[model samples]
Target: MAEKKTPPPNNNRQFAVWGLIILLMLIVFTVAQSGASRPAPGETFTFSDFRERVEASEVQSAKIDIPGGVVTGKLRNGEDYSVNVPPVSADPAGEILDGSGVPYEYAEKTEPSVLANILLSLLPLLIIIGLFFLVFRNMQGGGRGGAMSFGKSKAKLLTENTKRVTFEDVAGVESAKEDLKEVVEFLKDPSKFTRLGARIPTGALLVGPPGTGKTLLARAVAGEAGVPFFTISGSDFVEMFVGVGASRVREMFAEARKHAPCIIFIDEIDAVGRHRGVGTSGGHEEREQTLNQLLVEMDGFEGQEGVIIVAATNRPDVLDKALLRPGRFDRQIEVPYPDIQGREKILEVHMRGKPMAADIDVKYIARGTPGFSGADLANLVNEAALLSARRNKLKITMREFEDARDKVMMGAERRTLAMSDEEKAMTAYHEAGHAIVGLNMEGSLPIHKATIIPRGRALGMVQYLPERDQISQSRQEMIARMAMAMGGRAAEELHFGYDKVTSGASSDIEQVTRIATAMVTEWGLSDEIGPIAYKDTDQQSFHPGIGRGSAISPETAKLIESEIKRFVTEAHDKAREILTDKKDDWIALAEALLEYETLSGDEIKALLDDGTKPKRPDLSGGKRPTVSPVPTTKSSKGPKTIGGPSEA
Candidate 1:
C-alpha cells in the first residue's frame, strides 16, 4: 500500500533549530572565557598577592590577553599561574607588570573582525524574523474549529475546466430539467428575459427523496450553462463560535458574486433553514442568525441577479417560511421517483459501458422494480455486472440480473443459514400463505416472488410486484393491501395449529399495523373519523411530530386505537378465509417451496396451475364433491373468532 502523505515541517520547528544554534554559540563563548581565566597548575592568589609576587621578581615571564582582561606568567621556579584582574587602570595588566619591574612581554588587544561585527549587528533582526515567521505559520495553519479563521467560507468549487456531466449524463427527472432549462437560458443570455418584462428567478429549489438525483441535477445545470459552480452543504454554514455561520454565509455569497452568471448549489438546506421558534430556547440561537444572513444574501440588499441559487433538500417541510417565499426560491421543482419509462431510460444509461446478454430486457427489469429510485437502479446495474463477473461470464445474463434484483430488494441469499427440518416446513407454509392470499385477493397487487431462503433480518420474503406506478390509492385497494400484508400469519395459523403458530410473521404484522393506522388517523378512510385527518404533525411548516401541541381527549384517542385494530382484524379475517378454502393449493405451494427452496412469480403461477388441474377420485363412489370453492366475502368469518396473540 502507498504511504499516507504528511504535511511538511512548520516554522516552529525551524525556530527551535535556530534557537538551539544561538544557545550553542553562547555556551562556546562561556567555555572559552572560563578556560582563558583558569589559574595555572601551581596555586591561586588574591589580586594583591599576585601583584606582590609579580613585584618580588618571582615572575620570570608574563603574557596577557588584554581584550579578555587575563594574564598568564611563569615563575623562576618554572611553576605557571594565570590571573583575571579588573581593569582598575587604563592598562591594568601592563601597569601591574611594570610596577613589579619584572621581565614581562605585552600583547596588544585585538579588535573584532568585520564578519563578527556584521553578525552581532544582525542577530536581533534575525531573532525578530524567526518569531514573526512562527506566528505567521501558526495563523496560516489554522484548522477547523479554530477561533481565528471563521470568516472563510467552506464551499468547494469544481476547479477543472472540463464538463464532467451534461444533460445526457442525467437520465431521470425530466420535469426538473425542463424547469431548469429556463435558468440555463437565462445564464446564457440574460437579455432574452430582461428584454421582456420578466424578472429573472432568484433561485429554484429541488426537492426529492434521498437518492433521486437532486445533487446530480445541480451539476447538470452547471455543465449546461458552462458557468463556474460553487457547491456547499447547509451544514457547512454552521460553526461552534458565535456569529461564525453568518460570517460564512456572507463570504459564500460574496465569492459567488465574483464569478458572474454562476450557480451556487447548497445541498440539504434544511440544516440551516429549519422552522424558527422551536423548542424552549426559541430562535435566538446561532442557527437563526445564519439563516437570517442567508436570506439577506439571496434577495435582500444583494438582489442576487448574476448569481443563481439552487438549493436541495429531502425535508422541505422543515424550512423557514421566509426562505422559501415567492421572491426567493420562486420555483419548487420536485425530483420524484422515476416512472416505468423513465426507469428504463435510467437503466439503459447505466448499462452503457458494461457487456450484457442479448436476452436481458431493461423494460422487464423496470416493471419488476416498482419503487426504486435513480440511485437504486444504478446500483442494481452495477450489482448485476459484478455478479456476472463473479461467475466468470463474458456478459451479464438474465439469471444474474434476477439474482441481483432479488439481492437488492431482499437481502443477499443465505443458503448456508442451516434451518432445521421443522423450521423449514413452518417457513414454507408461512411464505405459501402470502402467495395464496395475494393471488386469490380481489384487486390486489401482483406477486413477483416467494422464497424461504434467509435474507437480511427475515427468514423468508414474499415479494409483490406492482404493475404500474401508483400515485394514489383508493379505499378498497388500501384494505386489500393491508390484507396481503397480514396473509403470512393467517396462513401459519391455519396450516399449523393456533397454539403452534410461530413468530415468523412479525415483519408482516408490523407492515399491516402501520398501513391500518394510517388509514384511520392520517388518510381518514374510517367512517368513525369522518374524513378528518387527525394527524400528528404541523401542517403549515410541514414539520412532522410538531403539530401546534394539540391535545386529543382520552375518549377520542381510544376510539382511534379501536378503529386501527378493527381494520387490521378485518383484513386478517379476509386473508384466513381465502387461505382456508384453498387448502389444497396452500399445501401444494408449501411442498413446492420445500422441494425448490425458492419460486419466482412465473414458477409460483405454474405450480398453482398444475395443482388446480382436475384429477380422478378413488374407484369407490365419491362422497360429496371434493372440489374446493374460491373464497369470497360470503365466508369471511373463520379466524376473526379466535384472537391469536400475533405480536409484530
Candidate 2:
C-alpha cells in the first residue's frame, strides 16, 4: 500500500514573500503606536496657571524636553509635573517665568519607538502559530487549492453522479461496450473467475477518435459495476516541479486500491505517455517519471488486484508501449465512427425529447449522414432544433433537418455575400462541369447536390455520396474521382481561353494533384511504378514538412512528380472531353443552378437524363505510356471570342 505524502518543502521564494509581508506589518504597527504615544497639542496648560504656581513659589527648577515640546518640573512637595508647550514660546510665558525666579533648562528628548521592539519580539510567535494552522488545513486537502501540494494527485473521486450513466445512456459503440461488459461481471463476482484459474483482466484501454465517447463508456462501466470511479486528465499528472508527478501517480493508485473493485480512469493519457527521449531535452523528465510510476503501479510487484486501471486517448500511437502491455491495459478496444444503423440509433437516442414533426424520418437523416460520429449526430439534432425554434416553429420539420445537415457538412449559405455577374456566371459554369462529369462517369458516386451559392471558403460546390457505405476504393474508382476533381478547371479552360482561365480552380487543382500523387506514391496504383509505394511520412522527422532526404533519390523524386503531373493532365483532358460532348446538358445544369442556388440529387439527375447518352472512358493505356497529349481543337461548346491553344 502506498503511503500519504506530507506537505512539500517550502522553497526560499515562499520564505521571502512571508518575510516581506511580516516586515511591512511591523513597520505599519510601529508607526501607528509611535503616533498614538505622542502628546496632543491641545493638552497644554495656560500660561496664567503657570504664573499662579510661580508666584506662590510652588514651582521648582524646570527643564524643557525640546523634541517632546513639554516642560518637566517638581513643585515644593517634590512631585513631578509636565505640560505641553511650544518649543519656541512667545515673550509673555518667557518673561513671566524669568521674573518668578524659576531656573529653566532646555534639553532634547533622546528615545523613540522603545516599546515597539518589545511588541515585535512577541509578535512572531502568534504569526508562526497562524501559519502552522493554515499549513495544516491545506495539507489535509492534499494542497489542491494551492501550489504547495502539487505532488498530491489531482484525480477527482466522483461519488455524486455515478448512477447517472449506464449502458443505456451510451449509443453507437456496441463493440466497445461488449468488450467492457465482462469486466463488470468480474468486478461483481471475482471468485467465480478465479475458480476457473482465470484472474480478472487487469486493465482495459479505450482507443478512438475524439468525440467518440471513450470517457463516457468508462463512466458507464462505473455506473453498472456499482464501484468507485476516479477520473483525472493526463495533463493533471504533470507539474513543473520534478518528482511531484511521480508522487501523484503512486498516491492515485493507492487511493483506488483502498476501494476494492474500483476503476481509475485517466482521460487523454497521451499527455504524460509520449515516446521517451523525444520531448524537451530535460524539461520532460517529470512527465517520464510520472509515466514510469504509472507503469510500476499498474504492473509492479504487489500490484493491486481489485483496482482496475482504465485509460482513454485519441492518440494511442504516441502512447508509451510499456503502458499498453498485458498486465497494464490488456484489452485495447476500438471505438470507431457509427455505421448507418448505428447512426440511426444514435439519432434516436439524441432526438428523444426533441419536439420533432410527426412526418420526420430518422432513417432518412441517418442515411444522408454516412460518416457522422455519435457526437456529431447529437450536434446535428441540436442544430435542427435550434433552427426550427429560430423560425418560431412549434416542432422540427424535415426542411430544418436538411438545412442543418447542409450547414454541418458544407458551411451555412452565405446569402449576403456580394458577387458581380461575371463571377457568378463563372462559378455556375464551374459547378455545372462537376455535375455533368459526375453523372456521366462509370462507377461514379451519385451526385447529391450542386450549388453556386457562396458557402464557407468556396464560391461553388458540387457534393456527391456513395450509393452505399464503402470500405475502400479501387484503383480505377480513384482515377475516376481524380477526373472529377479536374472537371472545374477543365470547364474554365474550355469556356474561357487557356490564358483567360481564372484562379477559381485553385482548390480543384489541389484536389486533383493530391489524388494523383497518392495514387503513385501511397496507393501503389501506378502500373509503371509496379506495386512500389513511398511512405506518407517519416518517423524521425522533428517537423511536419521538413525531411533529411527522400526514401527515393532526387532523380526518382522528379520521376514521381512527372508521373503525378502527367496523370493530372490526362484527367483534365478526360473531363474536357466529357464536358465538350455534353455541352448542352452542362449548359442546362448551369442555368438551373444560377436560377436556384440549391438543387437536390433527384433534381440534378432529372436534368441530365432529359436527353443525354452514356459515354465510356478509354482505360486501355495504363499510366498513359508517357505519351505526349494531342494539340488543341475548336469545339462548338467553347466561346468563339476566347479562343486560344488548349493547355496540355
TM-score of each prediction: 0.74, 0.79
Predicted candidate 2 versus true structure: per-residue lDDT over 1-648, tens digit per residue: 111243554565456657766775876677566645265332245556767887888887676665455666777787766666665644344466689888887665455566666656656775676577557645555355454565778787764242467888888899999999999898888898889999777888899988888888988888788777888999988877678789999888878888788889899999998888776545599899888898888888886888988889988999888888888887899999888788888899998987889889988888788778888998999999999999999999999998898788777778787665556666777788887887777767777777777766677788775555677877767667767777877887787658656676766676667777778877777776656766446542112133236656766676677777788998888899999999998878876766666677787776667733223232322221211132233222221110000111
Question: Model 1 off-target regions past 4 Å?
Answer: 1-149, 277-284, 538-553, 611-648
lDDT score for residue 409 of model 2: 78
- The predictions' CA RMSDs to the true structure, in order, are 10.2, 9.9
Worst 10 residues of 2 by lDDT: 639-648
lDDT of 1 by residue, 1-648 (tens): 111133442456555757866865775575456446444555556677778887778888887666556677788898877777664447676777877777677667556567666666776777677667657645644543332454678777763265467778887688889999999899999999898879878989999999999988888888888887888999887765558789988888888888888989999999999987774333347788888898888889658878999999999988899998987888899999899888999999999998889999888999888778999999999999999999999999988889998788766877787555566667777778877887887767777777777876667767776777778878877778777777778886776667766656666776678778788777878998668777776452212233335466666777877888899899999999989898899888877776666677787887788654223332223322222221222211111100111111
lDDT of 2 at 521: 75
| Candidate 1: pairs in clash | none
lDDT of each: 0.75, 0.73
